[model samples]
Target chain A: MHYTRDNMAGLLRSHDINPTHQRIEIAHALFSRQEHLSADQVMAIVNTRHSETSKATVYNTLKLFLEKGLVREVIVDPSKVFFDPNTSPHHHLYEVDSGKLSDIDAEHVVISGLPPLPAGMVTEGIDLIVRVRRTS
Target chain B: MHYTRDNMAGLLRSHDINPTHQRIEIAHALFSRQEHLSADQVMAIVNTRHSETSKATVYNTLKLFLEKGLVREVIVDPSKVFFDPNTSPHHHLYEVDSGKLSDIDAEHVVISGLPPLPAGMVTEGIDLIVRVRRTS
Candidate 1:
């Protein structure tokens, strides 16, 4: 599937976002790469060609995308957070030392036997993260 | 099962962490309550009576505790990170609306059908978080 800037704008509109120039660029960066990225990384990519986007704009735009349900946030650890483009049901595999992350299809994973939720509570989403290390 | 400051010292020693006064207080704040706490919450608790602990100290101490396996870090989402005192095998249930978090014993849950890891990679840890919301 081709992810053009035009397509990014369309995606943003469908998700009820304003599709500003910077927003479209940020969305294109994420959707086109289809990889997990931190806010710092997102800013770097958007400003690689021209130093136009500020750090605050990158952060604000990412937060906006999150609020609009256009991306998923993956917290690899306390200090690391990545924005994921694919919002479909899935899990994550993180390379500990390398800081690499990839998606794990939810269909192949089976998680069961969890205790029932507390009274009046309903499930919103389940996040499964498997951290791995390179064998010596 | 008693988690007193004295025991906190011993626990720190066993884990090879230096039991400084602030470190012990931080440990007590986490272990005594056996609850998930953020650095900000930790600092607040450690200084609830006496304003002694600095934000940097609390953050560094928590990092030390994590490196020494004295605690587990729970990332409920992008903006929320909690330090869990219970390090035994377990999962987590997070309240999306109220931001309450609880532990799920790993013994009762069964996870299967994950795809094989890429060659040369070994599993370090698996985190399963079930996000629940209060029924409206």
Candidate 2:
């Protein structure tokens, strides 16, 4: 379901963040946009409708979102970072030509199995980013 | 196998990289170490033994290693980049407490079938990284 205003409010409450108008708008932009975005890109979009939202605010809000586990950061390119709003376990195909990112559902690739962690080490979560180049 | 001089030479040759003495030594230091390292860390080790190896060489060699697909770069932590000598297709678990990384073989986690890529997009390799935090 689309992230309604109520949903954004609930998310802010759960994360202990104030559901300010700017925060809600930012969240709505992220949740509504299907494509991955960089912080600068998010800021650009937020500024289009709301001129009061500062770049620093956008960065801080994104950090808060990441801390609350509401967003995922993709590092397909070593130089730049992309943020994905979808929190579900999934992989990505990074288009080398366009620098566009698309999510791949977790159900698709057959993960053979992961080797056990070393002694005294604990397992956490997994990130799979598939980088794609144009073959044709 | 222990990454001896000969072993390093063989690895370089296998990857079509010219096995310079410096490259072999850097390879030895990288493969022999148990910890994941940044280019600076590799430089530290190489300079300790050979005063002639400059930072430029370390960066260049690391780039060569990465280009040849002999090493993997871990992006779990944004502060510093870590390089993995293990080139096998596997995931990683980042220890949030210690910032240590360990390889997870591809067999443990089952990555099933993947969703189709968007129209005009092609599938590429996948990157899986698991971050873990201790409850205590």
Candidate 3:
């Protein structure tokens, strides 16, 4: 999904977030590619266009996006966390060797025998990460 | 799986890890309870017996355990990493509110619709973590 500046602005606005220049740049970096990216990767892409955003801003913006439901976080690796632009209900295919991530259609995957929620606890969300490596 | 000191020693030997005092204590802390715990939690428990281990030791030992396949790392939270002693192929139920983690029998959970592996990529491992919160 290609996201123009206006489209990204509207997205942030709809999520009740101020469409600051930095936020817009971060959103563009994520929504434009429609792929999973880490904060460092996002910063790298954002800086590639000569638009400088502080590391603090990148992390804070990502956190804000997550809180506002504008993006999702994928936790497959211990060292780094991935941010997904597609906030819809979906899973991930993580290449362990290369540290690459791809989307998995949630509709296509089936889960069964999920035990009932423990007492007093509700189901918030489920993260299904399929870690894969090179066939060689 | 009850793990006594001897059992832990045997496990380390089987995995080619020298059964040092700290490693054995760490292993016992994990295998004895069979629950997902963070390094801090493990350290807290290990130090309870007055057998103190440095923070670096705890972190390093956990890393070593992960590499040796004696434990699994769960990265649901970016700030703190959880380690699971049950090295068997399985999934997890992560309580988002309390940070509680429980095991989901690998046999009970099933996954489908995995995409074709990228060229030259092999299947490493899959981590399915179901994040939940309290109902109240």
Candidate 4:
């Protein structure tokens, strides 16, 4: 589906999110490119479109997106967290030095020995991160 | 091996750490417990032993330990980063609600289909986190 501003309102509504004008713009910033973006990156994109977004707005919007299951938070590096637009099952490949992150197809990877969850608990999700660095 | 303050000096020196009194106290707090500890927890534990340590001292000493390969940083929760005493190869099981973390034996787990390194890049490490929540 095309992730333009027009579709953002409906998408947000479907996700049970209040599609305010600012939220739509922030959602468009993340969904349009379908890339992993940090809060700063999202702000940078949204700011180009309009000047109404404050840092707190962008942060709150992102947190709302996370809570509504609209985006996944990727924390490969502690300092630089990324919000992944694609929520499909997948792993991550992180370039440590460059701080670049990309998806690794889950179908191509095999992770075994996942223990049964403790009684009264359910599995939320699994995150596998492969961190790499350039030969120095 | 017992992790006591007396041994921390030698351990620090072996890892090329300076083994200052504060460093040894901090190291002993982490290694002696052999559990994942947040910076605050480390501070709390060290504060009881002595009153000379500051917040900056605790943070810098932990950074030094991490750089010197004496500890591992676990970022399960964004706000509460943990310092792991055990450096052995292992994964993590994170309790979403209780904020409890435990080691998962990497040997029992089989992770296959690790792609070859990119040209001139090398693999730093892989982290696998199993997140679970209480059935509520």
Candidate 5:
């Protein structure tokens, strides 16, 4: 989504998130890129432009974004978690060697035969990641 | 696999992992339990029996185990990573509220329609985790 500062603020407002300067800057850092980024990566990018955003703010804002349904967390690696700006339902392709991520459009992939959920459990989400490595 | 101490040592030797006292203890801690455990959880369990095993040893041994294909890392939660002693290809069901993980037999789940890999990339593995919450 093309987001100017005003539109970014509006997006946050619509989600009932307070559009603070730090939140808007973080939103810009995420939406402006096509890649999924870790919270540390988000902090680095946000600080590159807005020098005042703290690491704590980045972490807090991301938790808020996740709770507000503005972003999704991708956990392909044990060491770091990636934050995805695209809220649309989809899967992922993770490049193992370089730790890069790409989207697998939800429309293209088909998954079936998930066993019946244990009694009294409802699905919150499904994460399907296909890990890949660059051919030498 | 039923692992007496000698069998655990043999298992390590078969995998080319040195059957050090610490590695053996770590192996027993994981293989003896049916549930997936994080490194901290592994350390906690190991230390309960053998107080000398340090955190670094747990981390290093897990990395070694992952490289040797003796364990698989489950990445369902962003907050912590779980290690599965059952190395066979399978998927998982994560109980979000309780953080419990259960295996989904690989043969039972079927997936298709993965997009063609980007040029010069080969598939490594695929991870499918269905996240669920209790219906109260």
Candidate 6:
């Protein structure tokens, strides 16, 4: 994806978001960075450029972005929440030491043969989380 | 997978956990039930029999069971956490209406062939959640 400022603005506009200076800067930081970040991390970066950005705003913006499908919220660690700019279907590789996250591009991870829906219930979605730890 | 009381007590003993009355009752409630339950739900049932069963103890027992790999935690919904008794490698189907979870026994959903790991970063695991809405 192109990381140009205009491209980011246009992307936000396409989602009907106002593309404010704070939102644009936040989007750029998220898209430019290759690592997964929490709201605090994003706020830390955005605050350097825009001192007026509040923690509540950052939290709200992230929630809005999540609702718009612009980003994905990951809860690999129960204590912390991570956000990913890549919204495509993929998996994540969590780092135990640094508490970081990376993408897993697998071709054979499609789930099938689901059991019939429970009585008076309809199926919504399937979630798979594979936890791995270092062998050494 | 014998669903009898003695069989479950034996199973717990096999896992090296002391099969106390509370533990056995919790195990039976989880194994016999067909739906995913949260700690609150487990406590609700456990309290019906033993009025002294506190929520804290139920929570602690659940944690112990999870550490022993006897149960799994499902987080399809961000607001509440759910517990699954199935320990095998599998996925989950979440119900949107009731926020219920069911096991998906697909064998072909293993994720593989991801990008190379970054320096000082080790892959831990992957979490895949597919959200489904009603058609009507």
* Best of the candidates, DockQ: 5
Query: What C-alpha lDDT does candidate 3 achieve relative to the native structure?
Result: 0.87
Count the clashes in each prediction. 0, 25, 7, 0, 0, 2
- Residues B8-76, candidate 4: write the lDDT tens digits: 899999999888988998999998888999999999998995577999999999998988888999987
- Per-residue CA lDDT of model 2 for B26-91, tens digit only, reads 898888885689888888888885496888899888888988898877777766678888877777
Clash count, candidate 4: 0
User: Model 5 over residues B69-125: C-alpha lDDT tens digits?
Assistant: 889888887778899999888999999999999999989678988788899999889
Predicted candidate 6 versus true structure: per-residue lDDT over B13-55, tens digit per residue: 9888999888887888788884688888898887885585777
After superposing candidate 5 on the true structure, give the runs of residues whose Cα lies further than 4 Å from its correct spot: none
Q: For residue A51, what is the lDDT in candidate 3?
A: 64
Q: Which residue pairs show collisions in model 1?
A: none
Residues B1-136, candidate 1: write the lDDT tens digits. Answer: 7988899899999999989999999999999898999888999988988799898998898988999999998877667679999999999999988888999999979999999999999999999999999999
What is the Cα-based lDDT of residue A44 in candidate 2?
Answer: 87
lDDT of 6 by residue, A93-126 (tens): 7666556567775455644455555555544434
Q: Estimate each model's TM-score.
A: 0.90, 0.80, 0.89, 0.94, 0.94, 0.78
Cα lDDT of model 5 overall? 0.89
Residue B108 accuracy (lDDT) in model 4: 77
Per-residue CA lDDT of model 1 for A72-100, tens digit only, reads 88877657679999999999998989889
TM-score of chain A of 1: 0.96
Question: Which pairs clash in model 3?
Answer: A122-B135, A133-B121, A133-B122, A134-B121, A134-B122, A135-B121, A135-B122
RMSD of each: 2.2, 3.3, 2.2, 1.6, 1.7, 3.9
Question: Of the pair 3 and 5, which is ahead by DockQ?
Answer: 5
Chain B TM-score of candidate number 1: 0.97
Q: Each model's C-alpha lDDT?
A: 0.91, 0.79, 0.87, 0.89, 0.89, 0.73
